[model samples]
Target: MGRRYDRLIGSLVGTCAAFAASPAAAATAGAPHLDGAEMGLIWVVPFVAILLSIALFPLFAPEFWHHHFGKVAAACAAAFLVPFLVVHGVSLTIYEVVHVSLLEYLPFIILLLALFTVAGGIRLRGSIIGTPAVNTGFLLFGTLLASWTGTTGAAMLLIRPVIRANEWRRYKVHTIVFFIFLVANIGGSLTPLGDPPLFLGFLKGVSFFWPTQHMFLPMVVAATVLLAVYFAIDSTLFRREAPRPSDEASEETFGIDGKINILLLAGIVGAVLLSGIWKPGIAFDIYHVQLELQGLVRDVLLLLITFLSWKLTSRENREANGFSWFPIIEVGKLFAGIFLTIIPAIAILKAGTGGALGSVVSLVTNDAGEPVDTMYFWLTGLLSSFLDNAPTYLVFFNTAGGDPAALMGPFASTLLAISAGAVFMGANTYIGNAPNFMVKAIAEERGIAMPSFFGYMLWSVGILIPIFVLITFLFFH
Candidate 1:
């Protein structure tokens, strides 16, 4: 009992120290900023409430989290603002560095929602893609495909089928856990499209193909280890199933409506690419015209594809899969909160990387001839689990910019380290990654209660962390 108390105190002290030493803990060099206590009140108060809403309030306010995620997210925003005001005392100076209008991260959040909604709508009936035989194969495909479709896209495509194939198993959390470990995190380490950090590198003059090269080996190693572990765990759980009735067997069916929905999806991608390529050719430089066009095209494509998928796919498939926008809506609502609440935190990070905070070595070379960054990749990845990986990636990218080694060969190794850290570690907690909470909410909507935030961490510590440590020592180090 005394040891436990001591451990708790040590944890609190460590947290306080981390907060005090955080690069974003202070204001820009020239400006006056809030003291540690004031910053603590703003960030910590709302953070504690979020933890309460997630872990404790569910006991009393059964519907509270689902019904009021927007409120909670907004409360976080208010927390950030109130302290900003207290520090500045009604001055407009806060506006110069922290712009509330910089809430441009919203559309990307929406894009994730729409993208997942479409993925959730797709299900296969006795399809090869959804079969247990193809489990390892599809996972690899999804992992490789992530660079093009995005990590969330690959996860959405693969998760349902993984669940379907393992439906008969009683101990199925193992499957979901492994799925989160691989499909959601490790699979997306190869390219900018696969994960957000690589995307930031692309925007900053790193070639599109750079991350893919370096990430290949690490990704291969991680995937191999995870697949082997999954197979062993799954083998232990796989049991003989009682035969289903003939009528139940005959009832199952699946197919896409036509090729149109697929075509529509293709068109959206093409339009986005064209918008990006043609931006420089246009007379007026409308900011993010590519993004605007891409969004417009994407929504139109999704609507058309959704209709086609509904009309073309078998009615039985729809019946078996009953419709619910709740999953997507829940993601929408929850992400709204995450987007708003974390904006200031991200802004602070960006500000610090832009010279508000003092400079520190972002990267270092280890004994194994591998280059590693302290602030650049590891920290970016650590935060990416809880925050948006995109912004997290940007923080590191911005920090590493202008450093010579950042420009050269085998940069993908560093990129892979960053990507693995961000994508995989997100499974450490329910809120670690956007998809973790969204997936949990979706599963619960389907009547499967995922582990709590800390409960999930047990898996990370016992199983995943050891794997990560191996990765760090063997591959990344």
Candidate 2:
């Protein structure tokens, strides 16, 4: 244990030391940034390693994973940073690290933490049966709720209730899988409030109602198909399982405890909306990274909300809900690794036809450079299924010509492709979006084996890919 602790500390020190070596170099001439055009494919290996680690370790080495997953995360982060430090030197490395940590990672985790805390406090009290109708209704409600409260908010709020509803069922993995599909991912397509990527678009001058106007049809198609399919699978499983005597015998009433948290969830939505709408036009410069006043306000407000929710709810309040901080901690640590290591990948993709993945960039256009909406959809989606969907959306948004009016008018279909791809295909993997991981963790905590990472992909690849293909034919093509 001591050695493991020492190793973890070493990993942390190594990663941090590189970034800290030259704080005063923020104004270094030439801007000292990573030229993704010069970087090769090797820079992305660390990101791939972490993905494989998350997928394989739990399945093949559960004991080691449960014991030292944080250390593994730290080591993977170091593997990326230490090498980049050697190649780029401390100045550029520090700039890139601070850039992402402050502007991207911090905001990402803060929003998630706020939603998780507030949602965890809202305990649904009842012996809701695991009947097909009940489970389907829960998912439908969560899907509708996601676009308003945020996917993290919706998923965190109802995952426990949904799990509690189905605890008695033997064939229940399918329910959680479909919940991820419709509720956590596809459901977030209606507005910027729905998901981080859409919110990023909102910040980038995409109109508030743009997603609602354009993405509504695609979101409806995906949700309706998945919900219907989930209902059928669950119904068949419901009939196959041996019915317990108390399944229908108990006349349990449904109710909610810690009802105040319902209001806090709304506060969360307001705080996020305020960040987008109530821009105060002030800024803070943290080591050359620009921090806007509205952003800081949103983050602080969210933290305060999280604290209030914790204090307002009693210990028993959350205990009854089976709410634990483990899921959030697990997501925070693993995503810290994911975000840090993915720096190069985002940079490379952002470089367009000059980076190592130029062939990928070239695919979205033809010899005449016309925007092929179909390729935009598939590429953005396939990349988003692995990379952080927010930046992936930004990359393709810029690729489609970053002028909002033009994209919203002349290139409307192209913008729709990018938006739908990022928002919907996030359901393609547990790591594809923040909420997916949280939902998986919470479900597993309730003793659902869920699926192994690749095992889960089997579900996504078999189920979601076809849906996306159908969407392509119906819309993008």
TM-score top scorer: 2
lDDT of each: 0.47, 0.73
lDDT value for model 2? 0.73
Supply candidate 1's per-residue lDDT for 211: 60
Clashes of each: 3, 0
- TM-scores for every predicted model: 0.66, 0.82
Candidate 1 C-alpha lDDT tens digits along 222-328: 78887887766665555443433343333445554323434544543454344234323222112211223433443455455555555665555444444344444
> Which model scores highest in lDDT?
2
lDDT score for candidate 1 against the true structure: 0.47
Segments in model 2 whose C-alpha atoms lie over 4 Å from true places: 1-31, 163-173, 199-209, 233-248, 383-412, 429-462
Any residue pairs clashing in model 2, and if so which? none
Over the stretch 43-117, how does candidate 2's per-residue lDDT look in tens digits? Answer: 888877876676556546767876787899899899999999998898878888776676656666677677667
RMSD of 2: 6.0
